[model samples]
Target chain A: MSSSTQTAQYNPAYHRFTLFLAICTFLLIVAGALVTSNDAGLAVPDWPTSFGSLYRIPPMVGGIKYEHGHRMLAEFVGLLTIILAVWTQRKEARSWMRKLGWFMLLLVIIQGLLGGLTVKMRLPWYVSTAHAMVAQTFFSLTILMTVFASRRWIGSTVTLTRHPDPGALSFRNLALLTVLAVYMQLFFGAGFRHGGLHFFPHVVGAGIATVILVWASFSGILRFGNIKPIRGASIAILGLLVIQLLLGFGAYMTRVVWGKDAVQPRPSMVATTVAHVAVGALLLAHCFMLAVQAYRNLAPAAELSPADQKAVVA
Target chain B: MKFRFGLLLILLVAGCSKNETPPASYKPEAPTAKIDPSTTATVSGVVTYTGDVPKAQPIDMSQDPACVLGKVPPNFGEAYAINKGRAANVYVYIKDGLGNYSYPTPPPATLDQKGCRYVPHVLGLMVGQKLRILNSDPAMHNIHSMAHENDGWNESQYPGGDAIEKTFNKPELMIPVQCNNHPWMKMYVNVLSNPFFAVTDAEGKYTISGLPPGTYTLGFVHEKMGEKTLKITVGAKEHAVAGPAFSSADIK
Candidate 1:
């Protein structure tokens, strides 16, 4: 196969790996839910240890189940990403792909350390929340890697007229704004997840950010008709926003639906918190998609001259 | 290939070192309390409330630099009663002269957060034993307990979460427990060598039972209220009443 064709080939392993990662991410999130649901934040008091003993598995107690389960899932994911990175290095010739593999490896290690620190430091809210944020980012980056590796996500050359379109900047701005807004929203969401509702402001701030995300999605969809994917992503974001909003309310109100008061949070909080995290992951993915779309539209391609290709090699 | 193989073998051997067990014949002493049993028996008391405690101030943990600007609730490190206008959640125990009875291995204990407050405002547990910390809220809460002896451990838990199980390797007198998430949520954990400690009731009364018929020093520890000590004699069959008249100011 020609280099271009070979590069373009639909690698089944890439798809399989992406799917595997997706499933694993889902399971990991569920494991996180179990951890939270079981109230097992500090089952292992020492970071990376159960009762100060390094080798002893944390007993399958309520908190231990969650905390240790989280640790185990993290290790599983770490190994998976290491394998994925190694596979990419072995099979991929692209420098970007190689760099991405290395980056993924670094991120997985950092993520693992962060998990340990969260335990060692007794799960400080900020560190704990940042730990969650990095996990979502890791998930998004892996998805991006999969996208780049897939045949459909081609870095295609596009022709545009010299006359600039008036709506181009708006689209660019909207894309950038969406990324920033979604990230900020996720940060606040992390605060909410880690703040323990003792701080009323964080609670209110998260609610406000959710509201803005909903509004931004609606407005972006209505205004950006030229960018189909942008509009689609916006609409999808809107839907997730609604679900998250309802999840929050359901978490708050449905205690009575389960024969409890509104003030009491239910097991649904675990699922809702996880879903909230997952949606944030999706938003980051969409942001990456928009960035790629924008970059592709603007970059000029000359079929990489032989000299450029040689330079890439060196 | 030989180098890599040799390195892997070395790593495997290194990992195997973790599995070595200690000599089985070596017997260890019973998990005893931190206090010297021979010293004057020091008495320590903790008062506990079964009802809700009113927040002296509103604690808000809404923004970054968590709890920086927010008002430190009156109970930041202090304990008080909420309903019935009675002081509850007080502690009075024997701190010195514990020479006769060694502190037992702390039995498994649970510190549950139900309705935004620690279920038992004052928890009594042994050194080197596990104590389960449970969070029943739907909100994220950070449990920051400042222990003088044990390495201070802090942790954040999501709601409907399981307990944060922890063990203090060393004995601690009175570690203040605070929720950094909720400045108002505060409690105390008293780590002792013996279970002879008792928390005071709403009536401002406390009692230490199971004394081994000897003279010992007694002490009381209350958050913000400080600690108190007195010498007392424990008879095998005599029931002893500590106090209802001790003032918070006096303890401080």
Candidate 2:
């Protein structure tokens, strides 16, 4: 259970590949956001084919670039996910990890179907919103797989043998709550972007999510700063939150204020809105990772009876 | 790595099999009956509004400098072109009572993109009639046809590019055409089976002449205010007046 012994279990190549896949997934998200921002969801008009040909590259002009570029990137990401799953199944010793890989594959396939449905159905608000939400989920899964394959996770497995700290347990619970709040806010944000829901709910969700995230990050830093993984993820989440807020404000100004009279999607509006969405995805992933790290590094206090707690303390 | 390459090959092959051809363009059949000018009646109307008219909002075309470099910026609030309570751009057409007597298709309709706005905000054309979409502005524009009944298309057109020729096969009430490059640029294209439709001009006056004598349902459609129908009986060589008044309550 020692750190040095756990190092033997770490697969650096697999971990690096997973991290690469996660980065690509994030880029795919950015591409998808650009497509929505440019209002080019139906630029190609057909699914699985761009302008009636899949192999032949269409003219990447105007909205077609954003729409077709997104599809190409998604295909690349889908290929990466397939490789990741197959590798995990063949090499990973953990049965749960293998299952997680296959689950990611399933999610990616579902994501692709939802994207096709969004286009074939002419961007129905619900289908488009669901496509956006599923992209977030797929990105989070990649992040989770990346975290699971990290050396830190392997080394921290020994923490399970130590006595459960009640404070860390509460912090873990708070991190989980923060993750849920961030996800709910993302749902509202997707709904607003797709025109299914009004902006009021998204704004309100942002306020609530910000409050909970700030509380969780500050508490994690103040109480669990000694834990490397928890402190690192908490600090990253706080930094991402600041950038996300500024981007959100810029998006609002560009989209609602300056962009009100714009005949077309302005470069500034598209940039800021896409950045806000990208940062929102990053914030969600970081929040989820923080929760996962807390759970991995700190055992739940509820699992220990009073006698067992006393014995462990002694 | 070999497995990954093999999997990629499989995906590429799998994608090759899904060759879905684009839907065929709809073409309307030629008219069967000829119109008699001597027996035809005229339907004229003044589209008047009873409620407060929405103020015209100034459009900011600064996003695309070419939109205002040498041209006047269009008014975004053209959605409600009301002059002293008279509404312009209202599409008044025969909704019913044509009795399957088809009329000859009219000449091609032109939807020009000048100053980053559709020249005619609202237009009506016979089904299967050619629609020439021209981009006269210096900036790039994408013409997106949001047609529910017909095939939808989104194509980008460069400034001074060749005109895009399109035709609708079915009689759809209205198909919204927009330029995604400029969100403020929008126009409605109404396709009809017969040539008995007219759009109200600046004075809110619309005249639809050469209609065969018959009982017809006149449909007045405003972009914001939903459709209003009126039953009218037109006599031969007679001029029928359709004074359809749309109020704020009719806003859809």
DockQ of each two-chain model: 0.06, 0.19
Question: Best candidate, lDDT-wise?
Answer: 2
The residue ranges of model 2 lying beyond 4 angstroms of the native Cα positions read A1-8, A159-170, A302-314, B1-90, B94-121, B125-144, B147-174, B179-185, B191-195, B200-205, B211-252
Model 2: per-residue lDDT, tens digit, B1-252?
A: 366346434544433432355555555555567777899999897999988765555666665567777765454658888888899999999999886576667889999998878999999988789999998887777788888887777776768999999988788876888775566678899988788899999999999989899999999998889899999999999998986899978765
Q: After superposition, how far is residue B153 of candidate 2 from its true place, in Å?
A: 6.3
Model 2, A63-164: lDDT tens digits are 667888899999999999999999988887777788889989988987897788776556767678878877998898899899888887765565544335
Q: TM-score for the first chain of model 1?
A: 0.76
Q: TM-scores for all candidates?
A: 0.57, 0.72
How high a TM-score does candidate 2 get?
0.72
Model number with the top DockQ:
2
Q: Give the TM-score of candidate 2 (chain A).
A: 0.91
Point out where model 1 deviates above 4 Å: A1-6, A46-59, A155-169, A196-220, A251-266, A297-314, B1-89, B92-150, B153-187, B190-198, B201-204, B207-252
